[model samples]
Target: MAVLFSVIPLLLIALAVYGAVVVLRRSRQVSSAWSSGITAQARCVRSYTTTNRSGDSMVRTTLHHVYEFTTRDGRVIRFDETDGPSTRIEGDIVTVHYLPVRPELATAKVPAPGKLAASTGCALLFLTVFIAFAIFLIVVANSDSMR
Candidate 1:
């Protein structure tokens, strides 16, 4: 049980580190993509499906495809890598920053930096709380066995 407690914390820290690294990589990539003129992004979409798991029904989403948005410059853009979840949505007129050479590889601009920061903070807080709870569970289990 004590081992579980310690392992939980290590896992949380590892996730936090991973998130930081991702953010850093994104920051660098976005900077290089920002050009002097307008860069367009495709209309992103997700296919919804209804499914039941363990008696609880829920809507599940999967990547359908991406539609390239045409700017005045007549350039088609899409994602260079499809591994990451999309940050855009249909009918969303998001500001896109793309590499001049590879317009397909682009990132949608966040409308509000402060709001995004707040959301990121909340996500981190939730992760921390979950980790704490896991640790508490292990501690209680171990102490019970000790008695």
Candidate 2:
């Protein structure tokens, strides 16, 4: 029981660190993509819906879209955009942003700088609260051992 209590706090700390790294990395990637990516027009080739059974027999349906675009160097690239505008249908043209060197990291929409900042701030705030809770758990476990 004592071991379980100590292990739980450590697990929380590990989770906090992992979450921070993931959030920071994603923020950096989006920032870089938004700042330096090349702009191109892509045409929606197909749109499809996928349904899956989530938890407790709940069904979740997701709409997926595939788009194709021509690079400046005369190369054609086809990619999937899952979180794109739901109103887009096949044959609709959309603006795409991608890095010249990493075209696979293309996005149909770049988030506004203010929105990105707010999202990162919110994620970090949650991580801070999570770490504080983990630290409180560690202190409680240690004090109990001392008594």
Candidate 3:
């Protein structure tokens, strides 16, 4: 039983590490992939209305666009914007940063510089919370072992 308790915290730490790695990797992939910027006008924007099990509605958005581009690695990503609120905008002048390898995949869109930074900060904040929680669990479990 003690072994199981000890293992559980380690497992949580592992999971936390995995989550952090995934987020950081993705962030890096997106940052590195962003190649060029374009003057894209918003084509369409719509907010989503999601219903949960308890019948509550959640608001989300889906943005679309039509544009052209070249990749940094000569991937030739083309066509419209297909990402929503958090990542894309339509009918507005957007500076799109795309991956060089896959011209089709854009790493990010900064609607406004300030907002993008805020979004990145929020993601990092959540990552910190998860990691801290994982450490706390390990510490508590280890202390219990001494008694």
Candidate 4:
């Protein structure tokens, strides 16, 4: 029982660290792309909607947008924006930011600087909480063993 309890907290901390790393890396990639990538105008070609049933039996629909753009080199690429649907129309033009080396890795919009920083901070905060609780657990287990 003690071993299980100890392992659980460690596992949680490990998972938190892994998640934080992934988010930070992604944010870094996007930030770098924005600074070093080529910008072009992409058009919303079409969208697909999916209906899902919520936990309360309410039906909800989500829209996935598909956009296409031509790179600076005149190559065309199409990608689906998984960040949910926007209010854009089929003919609406949107700015696309893509890395020159990896054109497929692109985003229609970049998040605010504060937003990205806040995400990293939130992940680290959760990690701090997990570490604190894990330390508390270890101390209690040690005290119990001594008794």
Candidate 5:
């Protein structure tokens, strides 16, 4: 039972760290794309929504859009994005930025510095909270063992 408690908190900490890493990496990628990427006009080919039911009455809907753009070299690329602008429907044109060498990593808009900082702060905060919680759990487990 004690081991189970320790394991659970450790797992949570690990997950938190993983989440932080993912967030940081994505931020770096987006930053890089914004700095050294090519701009193109992408046409929305399809707009769709996916509904997920969690329980008897709980439902979650996610919006997805498929866009196709032609690169400068005449190659066409199509990609799907989630939670894009709601006003964007099929046949609408939107601006996208992507690395020439990595066209697959396209983004609809440049990430603002403020938003990037906020996201990084949030991820670090999440990691810090989880680490503290895990340490607290270990302390409690050790105290119980002394009793």
Candidate 6:
């Protein structure tokens, strides 16, 4: 029992570190793409709404969007995105950003700085709380073992 208590904190810290790295990498990738990628207008070719029942027996609806864009070399690419229905419709034009070298790596928009910072902050905050709680548990377990 005591061995589990001591090991859990280390594992939690490792997990927190891994989560932070993932967030940082994603932030950098979007930032780089926005700075170095090309922009083009894409058309929303198809869209549909899916309805399903949740575990709580409540019905939920999800909107799926499919888009197509032509590269500078006259190549057309089509892909699906799940960023929500928004106000776009079939045959509507949307802006897309893509790497010139690898046009398939693209996004509808670069993440805003404010939104990225807020999410990173939230991840760190959760990690801090989790580590603190794990340490507290270890301390309590050790004291009980010593007594």
lDDT of candidate 3 over 61-107, digit per residue (tens) = 44455544444444444455435454433444444565444545553
Write down the RMSD of all candidates, one decimal each. Answer: 6.2, 2.9, 5.5, 3.7, 2.3, 4.1
Instruction: Give one digit per residue, the lDDT tens place, for model 2 in 67-146.
Output: 89988898898988665678999999988877788776677765587887898899999999988898888888888988
Which stretch of 10 consecutive residues in model 5 shows the poorest summed lDDT?
104-113
lDDT, candidates in the order shown: 0.57, 0.82, 0.54, 0.77, 0.84, 0.77
Q: After superposing candidate 2 on the true structure, give the runs of residues whose Cα lies further than 4 Å from its correct spot.
A: 46-64
Q: How displaced is residue 54 in candidate 5, in Å?
A: 5.3
Residue 96 deviation, candidate 3, in Å? Answer: 4.6
Query: What's the lDDT for residue 124 in model 3?
Result: 73
Q: Candidate 4, after superposition: displacement of residue 112 in Å?
A: 2.5
Better of 1 and 3 by TM-score: 3
* RMSD in Å for model 1: 6.2
> Residue 26 of model 2: what lDDT?
68
Comparing 3 and 5 on lDDT, the stronger one? 5
Q: Judge candidate 4 against the unseen true structure and give its global Cα lDDT, from 0 to 1.
A: 0.77
**Model 2 weakest 10-residue run by lDDT:** 102-111
Candidate 6 lDDT tens digits, 60-115: 88877888999888989886766544787899888887777767656665447787
Q: What tens digits encode model 4's per-residue C-alpha lDDT throughout 1-147?
A: 777767877787788778778877877767776777478899988877888897887998777778899999998988876554467668778888888777776777654678767877887788778778877887787678777
Candidate 5 Cα misplacement greater than 4 A, ranges: 51-60
For each candidate in turn, the TM-score is: 0.50, 0.78, 0.53, 0.72, 0.84, 0.64
What residue pairs clash in candidate 4, if any at all? Answer: none
Off by over 4 Å in 3: 32-35, 38-83, 86-96, 107-113
TM-score, structure 1 vs. true:
0.50
